[model samples]
Target: MRSALLHVSVPFVLCVTLANTSLFDEVKVDLAYDHYAERRVDYLPSFLAMPCNCLVNLAYIYMGLYWLLNCRGVKETEQGRYMREVFAFMAVLYAPVQWVRLASLRRAPAVLDQWFTLPIFAWVPVWISSIQRRPARWRAPGAAVVQLLSLLSYGLSLAHERGFEVALGCHVAAAVYKGACVQRDLGDGRTRVYLLLAVLSCAGFVVLKLLDHWLSRYWLFQRLTGHFWSKVCDVLQFHFSFCFLTTLTQRAQGKTASQEE
Candidate 1:
């Protein structure tokens, strides 16, 4: 996991850094407190200015840590652990990108906040692919290819005002389509529940964030804010994605073992 993180960090940093420059000038990013309906605390640090939304990021860390230690069978562990840890690491790494955006309110962190999201969502299909194929040999190389493409997909944002939205939409669609495909092929009742929850959570994540301002008009959302709930939904989706994928992997492994026996 450490080696994988290190390998990706180099190009990841470079890509986001490049995006922070004029290359991503046309990309739509929220840089002001006004963009969020949450009230900012004047006495607080920049990172904690909007306490509710900023602190909600901790959920991502907690979820990540929980899953990071959740290793299972020896056979499944070898291939499955890689996918799990990488996804968990992504959840852990994502919190700070969002917090930094709230704190520094800079173009770079904002760019990072957007750029990091693509691969995180794209990993859904990557994990699904591993389960659909020869897991032992194919997972690593296949993940590398998918993740690289996910990173490059951000280049779409350079073209139009809604380029990021278009790219994100594609990632979301691919994840959903791939997830349904896998669920149809291998999922049981429990896996079906997890997949449904994951899809609902993903939808909530997108919808709540989009309605940040509109929902703020209501008393229920004024304090917690739609953006805050959106992060909550985001964390839930990650958790369920883990549940769905690992369950599928374990089921496949069990089938393979029974066949060999």
Candidate 2:
């Protein structure tokens, strides 16, 4: 009904907008014409360009804060409090990290982006611990330790001229680990379905990202605008992952409340 319409219309509208724009043009060394040169826009980077990236960052900030507020309204379960704290910390980190990312792009160096990305990924272990119903006390410290170690490793990698490779490897590994944990802990049919969709989204995310890098060399892909398609996938992937994760969390919380009643 309304949800179905939204699901369909959003992508349709986005594709139309992207197809009409020049944002997906192959990266050029010339900064004036290449606003998105070597930059990854989360959704519709082709049409929305820098604005799209900025808007996405803003959305993350808003959602993180909104969810934190929502958590505050819920019955004060240990899990709820932990989730609120996690969300608050993430919101704080996300704002400055996004600003730094934007600044790095403007200056044509990804050092700041790499540095901030470490903190973002730090949320993974904590998130996983929460999902597993682990003690709340363990989550934040675990995440902080992981973040610090990741930052140190990233710095060393950069000094050795393998920064990007290390970051990419860590990112991929973290994603795989998160997905695995989610799948393993799925206890119901609905959760399993969500996990499957999330897995598909992850696959699409990786494939589209790769296409963005190498597909331009192919004649057919070039005509179809590889970069544009990749961005489309990026947008879809982000939404799908968000849907799966949030829904999964809501379901778990609902079950917890029911059991307590």
Candidate 3:
């Protein structure tokens, strides 16, 4: 299973690496004060000019792909159902976020830039509506955890210029927590292994973030570029792990059913 995961991860890693390179070049251009200043003169172009905006857009694409491939029609147990609900909730929340992006900024904020911070209110009611229909088991602790992290990340972003970092960290942490919750609910060895790998990948990201913070320097762009490459590796690892575990679980289930027959 581990070997299979490594195989699946290769392409994702390559894509992330390429994306990082592109992001670095784009951000470097964005950092040029004169270019940025001139671009801001035209609101539409300036908003579109930010590389962080592009990164966020790309991240959304990845999120959608992950949901379609991993979350849709893949629930094998009640825990799996809960997991799906969580992601569905996320999808709901992200809808307004994307909409606001289009209507308000049309571009992404920098790591240090502040924009509209209260967009959560727009979609909070949607999540609440969904939560009300779900089973009570899926309501309290599970929904609480997800909502707490979501709101906390937004608040952190508002309080600090480096709010993007807080948001990313919260996201990684939520993924790990969700994986663990699913693993506990499923009781499948293969699924548990995949969850562990997901946790590890998120841990790798946390470490990279800490390193970046501790080693701050004026020429931090170089360091950020390096971290971006590392992020690519982690994403690849996550993709491969998920693919292999999913395959293994399906195969094992097939064997069990055949044996019963």
> What's the ranking of the predictions by lDDT, best on top?
1, 2, 3
Write candidate 3's Cα lDDT for 121-218 as tens digits: 21222232233233322354544454444544544544555655556554554445544544454447765666566556656645653454334343
Candidate with the larger lDDT of 1 and 3: 1
Give the best candidate by TM-score. 1
Per-candidate TM-score against the hidden true structure: 0.94, 0.56, 0.40
**Shift of residue 70 alpha carbon in model 3, Å:** 7.6
Once fitted onto the true fold, the runs of candidate 3 whose alpha carbons sit more than 4 angstroms away are: 1-63, 69-136, 140-149, 156-185, 209-224, 230-261
The TM-score, computed over Cα atoms with residue i paired to residue i, of candidate 3 is 0.40
Give the per-residue lDDT of model 2 (tens digit) for 140-231: 55655665566555544435555545675676578557756775775467656755665575566457545654765666554344444544
lDDT of model 3 at position 168: 59
Note the clash tally of each candidate.
0, 0, 1
lDDT for each residue of candidate 1 in 81-113, tens digit (9 for 90 to 100): 777888888888889889989998888889989
Superposed on all Cα atoms, model 3 deviates from the true structure by an RMSD in Å of 13.0
